[model samples]
Target: MNKILIVDDEPNICNGCKLILIEEGYDVDTAMNGSEALEKLFEQNYDLVLLDIRLPDISGIDILKQINEKRLDCFVIIMTGHGTVENAVDAMKNGAFDYITKPFDDKEIIKATAKALENRTLARENKMLKKQLYDRFSFDNIVGENHQIKEIFDKIQRVAALDSTVLLDGESGTGKELFANAIHAHSKRAGNRFLAMDCNTFSPALMENELFGHVKGAFTGADKTRPGIFEIASEGTLFLDEIANMDMNIQSKLLRVLENGEFKAIGSGKVQKTRARIIVATNMDLKKRVAEKKFRQDLFYRLNVFPIYIPPLRARKDDIPKLAYHFLKRFSRETGKQISGFSDDALEMMVNFEWPGNVRQLKNVVERLVIMSDTHQLSRGFLSDHLEIKRKGGVPDIQTPKTLDELKAAKKKFLTVYFGKIEAAFLSQAISRADGNITLAAKNAGMQRSNFSAMMKKHGIVADKSSD
Candidate 1:
């Protein structure tokens, strides 16, 4: 039950509310004047207060000011027989939750009081959630302790408080998106949503419509009004991932929006403004692309305002051990395995290998080794064959295949080595996995999608089995 305080100069009015509230399971208290109400307020905590404006000693507005000075967390509802709009507005300005005229309905008063309590509860909950999220992914979540990564972290801490356009450049495996998330989390706009979209996912035809929404019947599939990412991400941060893949024509429109913070939706005449901070990521070398005339030079300059380069895993081998241990612990816990730390040999193998696929590949390999290992300790033998290069080991000699003089000869030899059969069986397996879709299968085998087709014809890899 909620505690209620009713303060009014009229004895009949105060007694009536007290009797009704007590009957409805409230711990009701009554006061004849603002002085009495103040005394009662200090003595006991109440959830809601029904205060009469024209009290004998002091007005309700003065009482509210005194209550706010004391910093009590109670919702005040002002009641007055004067019933003037000016009086109601005055009461509202002095921290009153609502203003009710005398002879007000009982249901209306109860509804307003309930709503005030609900608002207080929601306000406290939102504050706590904000605190929790900030603590979880703060600067400490970044894993690397290398010199370059630490420098980047220092720069992030400095720049996060400002409103700047951040450009992240790195290879595909480098964690550019994570850096973008870190920027938003540390920024003043952390409470707002952090929206990310891959610029390459949309085609030229739909790119404009997707970024800036369209109206009903704007095109063939337009059924209703739609809000674009810009509109939805207003007053937030928008991360454009794989920005190098966006079409040339769309780049001009995006650049204009970045300059003026305003853009109109497709098929809409009205202009919309946004205060979103834009962060763009690109794996491709934009300067090279610009010199080649494949990308716009002007747009490149606009996005390169605060460029942050993410060093690849191979460049910072010092952090390899830390990343490996992090992934090892994560994989072990996830798989319900009691895996001890890696052996010295295993650590040596991992730290020496060039991680072409970077941290993502390291994580995948660790998880796989953990699942396959019977013992808790992971040894070098559990690592991938590629990582274990032969050095000064006293192991038994292994048979070596004949060397190939040319690329074609080596490719043919690779097929035989993988399939353990003649050239025909190798071609059959490749084409089969391709589902007769030779280009896709070639890509699956890490070959050029286009070049694979040519190789298939040269090696008799693709054929109509029915014709055979």
Candidate 2:
């Protein structure tokens, strides 16, 4: 139910307005003066206030200023008996939502109040929709049914409710920012604004001003007072990406803000307080940098309260199939394509390959395939030829397999084709790299010693024992 506050000095006008609003199904309250209205405002929340211009003690403009200074979201509809076109315009400039002339009709009052309430409702709904959309494409959007990916999703949800600063450690293209945004969207301040800043994109001066705001005439472009992300995002979340790239001075400033919730505007004497949640993400080795004294220890501690480490794609190969299909559906709809999905061979190749650029690289490759490939289903040739991803590693001089089938056949038919010849070559290389240690040679191939012996025997390859 919406609450409306009506403030007026005249008894007849105030009572008439109150009766009309109550009959229209509003919870109405009447204040005879500015002091009484202020008291009522402090007592309970109001959706809209019908403020009188000719108050007994306070001016209507002063009331508007007080509401704005308090940063309340209630809409104010000005009621003026000294009604001039100038008065209406001035009321609007002072943050009044709208103005209704005194001795107004019942229809005008009802229509004006309804419109103001509708605008407030729409503004709130828009904010909610943005928050929902942001959370929908968040860390959970990584899209993998594998245990490893599911674990990461669970971690994101678990840490989101806390006020601790999160350090998302992941390789490049691992969707670190997505995780940070997810955390922010799920936090208690989800209704507030979420601001993101890329540390790599700003210089120290611009970054400090952008984070902490500046007073007018603080620097060259100080024509007007400007609020920074921290001020704007107060009671919300601030996501800082590529945090390692930030300058040392800015790092200390960020540390101070996180520690004390206080920062001074550029060239300003006043210190401002922020209650924004900080979520920092980086791909660099902060520990190594800290040991080198290039990164500040205090800032590192403030950011690392809850660290989320994401492994590379190579370590989570089981998730490739799910990720591939997710990206496939996304790009197919985006590009107006009827692509079916990846073929069996394509999935196998993806599982065997190392994704150096991680999830980001995979998403790009899927987009490329969706746009360029003529077939409904993705093929191994498209992945291998277009993406240039190697399914298996070897020397640079090694010849490419004739086809993906040949590569697959190489795995299943290692006995007949490359048995004697390839076994000897592999054994010789392994022995040379391992300095004639059989145990080390076996370990390098991720094979048991017995399995290595069996392979050597099946291929009729001989390795000479070392002479003491």
Candidate 3:
């Protein structure tokens, strides 16, 4: 039950409020004066306090001041018989959550108490959500043991606590936003907002309004005022992904915010200031973009205060086994599969294949593998049939031949299986690049359209309906 305390010198007022609040399902306490109220407040934690401004022993403003000094989380509603605007303002200035006159009815008191307690509940829930977000993005969840990854970890450890701008460079699916979240969660402003924006996902005008917000009547269809990410994250962090893809017009405005914490909302003459820390990421070479005149050199310099590069999965093959097993364990529990681990040959196949889509691709593949598995261990042939991964200089396993006849038979089997995998992998890659356009894919591979379609049917690869 929500606890409430009523502080008033009038016995009738205190008793009436207590009875009304108790009927409303509250644990209500009464104090005849400010001193008794303070004693109760210090002795117990109350969700709401209903205080009268005029008390016989002490002033209610003094109690509010003490509450502020001690940094109590309870809400306060001021009550005064003197119904003057000045008294209400005074109460509010001293941190009163609400103000009411002394002649208020039972309905008024109940409403005030309910509203204050509602806010108290919301505050507790907000704190819990922030804790959950911090836990989700904590550095412990980022799995990697390679030396290159360790170096990045050291760099993050050094810079995560700083307010400098961060630039993350990596291919897609390398978890740039994860690094951004880690930085924000470790900073002094962790308790405040942390918002993310993708420059590539928004057009110039929309991006402007989204980053700087707009005032009411600033543009057509902009009926009411909206606060942008910059204003919302003023005391927190704003992460910008695909920073290199931002248009030049928007880049200039962003540069202004970086140079000075000032920006004007769209359609408004008023300038707004934001103290939000900036973190940007890109897959392209930023310096090259600057040289090509596609990106602003000044903005590039401002964003490069701290740079962290995440290597692709192919470059960190040494960590593939650990990553694979990690995904296996997670997917096993999620899919309720009895599969325990991978066969040695299966692990070798995954390690040898190039994962074009990086960790995300590997994760998706493992999820599917666990879902499809019927045995305790994953085998190389099973994985190969599902993955269609073909790499150069790798042949099907064959034992030493007992005689010439056996050798010929082994070569025939090896060539047929190995070359067939290559053909299937080729067709799959072509169709994917062509967006399922079989004719275009066949042309790209320098083959006839009918031949490509036949091969796709033979391999059970579905093709989308696209015009030649």
Runs in model 3 lying further than 4 Å from the true structure: 7-10, 31-45, 51-73, 78-108, 145-163, 186-195, 201-236, 261-276, 314-322, 344-356, 384-468
Report the alpha-carbon TM-score of model 2 versus the true structure: 0.61
Best by TM-score: 1
Best by lDDT: 3
**Runs in model 1 lying further than 4 Å from the true structure:** 1-104, 386-468
Model 1: lowest-lDDT 10 consecutive positions: 459-468
* Residue lDDT tens for model 2, 353-415: 776557877777788778888888888867765443323443222345799987776655444
- Across 1-468, the per-residue lDDT of candidate 3 in tens digits comes to 888899988899999999999999999999998889999999999889998888898888899999999888799999877656587688898899998886989889888888888887988887787777778777667788889888887888788788899999987667788888888877777878889987765668999989999999998899999999999999999999888768799899999999999999998889989999999988778898898898999999999999999898889999889999999999999978878899999999999887755777788788888988888999987888656564466666668899999999988867656877678789878977874445678999999988888886554444332210
* Model 1 agreement with the true structure over 161-216: per-residue lDDT tens digits: 88888988876566778888888888888878788987655667677877888888
As a TM-score, model 3 comes out at: 0.68
Q: RMSD for all candidates, in order, please.
A: 9.2, 14.7, 7.8
lDDT of 2 at 137: 56
